[model samples]
Target: MKVRDFMIKDVLTVNQNAPLSEVLQLFVAKRINGAPVVDADGKLTGMVSDGDILRYINPTRQTVYDMFSYVFVSPPEELAEALAYKVETPAKKIMKKNVQSVSPEQDLEEALGILAKHHFKKLPVVNEKKEVVGVISRGDLLKQIAGRLNELNAKTVSR
Candidate 1:
């Protein structure tokens, strides 16, 4: 099967300049974990996930040493400051630019290999112009496999 066969056609995307807070709200309202970031021309530029947002909003750690004793902690004020700054930042700042994507004509096994190697939850399906056409998640592939297996089983039983 091809990636186009099982990919989700109704893809959700965000603009590169979109505020991080807006993206986060979209994730919650849409109940989506991630989305591809697009350019003004509607071309895929990067990807953003809830994990990325969390990591960005997380405070940096600091280490202190006093006569051979060391202590590490993240200050509450620093975390609060980061949260404030991050909310106003643009999505492009935190989005993953090195996106792993598949072509619509690519084989399902190849897409699966990329997903497995990268440990990605979803892979964007892009065209030659680098525009996102669809998205394929592991669940989608599993569903297709299960449906195919059931069809084969039914055929075998009848014969």
Candidate 2:
């Protein structure tokens, strides 16, 4: 099977310059975990995932001084300020720049190899111009496999 066979054509994307807050809202509203980050020309520049957002919003860690045996904690106000700044930051700041994507004409196994190697849930399907045309996910591949299995089983039973 090819990626285009099961790829989702209606891909949802986010602009690189969009605020992290807006990306978070889009994630919630769309009930999606991540999206492709595109430039003004709709070129695939990066990918932003919920994991990236969570890491961005994570509060500053406490520091410990071994020699002085002193522990320094980040104040609530400082944490709040950091969060405020992070929310206003653009998605590009937190997005993974080196994105692994597949082409629509690529074989399913090739996409699966990329996904497995990267431990990614989904991959953006891009054209020759690196413009995102669709998206393929592990779930999509699984569904296709299941459908094929069912068809095979039906054929065997009929025989």
Candidate 3:
């Protein structure tokens, strides 16, 4: 099967210039873990995931080294503080650039390979113009495979 056969056509995306707070809201509201980042013209520029947001909001640790064996440590910044500081940051600042993507015409094998090799949960399906046409998640592939397996099992039972 090709990507277009099972890929989700109603893809949710975020603008590159959008703030992290808005991105977070979108993720939560849509119940999605990630989305493709688009430029002003709606072309795919990068990708962002919930993990990326968590990493960005992680607080920095403070440590100081005093003489030979002396050391001082300060409490890490609060999570809320870190979050407040980065909430207004632009999506382009944290989104992963040069993301691997697939075309709608590509075979499922190609999509599977890319997803496994890169440890990606989802991939953006793009058109010739590099516009995001759809998205394929690991769940989509697994669901298709499960259905096919059930069909084969039923055939064997009938025989």
RMSD of each: 3.4, 2.8, 2.8
Q: Would you estimate the TM-scores of all the predictions?
A: 0.86, 0.88, 0.89
Candidate 3 TM-score, C-alpha based: 0.89
Give per-residue lDDT, candidate 3, residue 94: 92
Among residues 3 or more apart in sequence or in different chains, the pairs in candidate 3 whose N, CA or C atoms overlap within 3 Å are none
lDDT of 1: 0.91
Error (Å) of candidate 3 at residue 134 is 0.6
Candidate 1: worst 10 consecutive residues by lDDT?
A: 68-77
lDDT of each: 0.91, 0.90, 0.93
Candidate 2, residues 1-159: lDDT per residue as tens digits? 788998999999999999988999999999999899999999999999999998888877655445567666654446677787788899999999999998999998899899899899879999999999999888877898899999999999999
Q: How close is candidate 2 to the true structure, as a TM-score?
A: 0.88
Clashing pairs in 2: none
Mark the regions of model 3 whose C-alpha exceeds 4 Å error after superposition. Answer: 65-75
Model 3: residue 81 alpha-carbon error in angstroms: 1.2
Top-TM-score candidate index: 3
What lDDT score goes with residue 117 in model 2?
91
Q: Model 3 over residues 1-159: C-alpha lDDT tens digits?
A: 888997999999999999999999999999999999999888999999999999999898986757778877777799888887899999999999979999999998999999999999999999999999999999878998899999999999999
Runs in model 1 with CA error above 4 Å? 62-74, 78-81
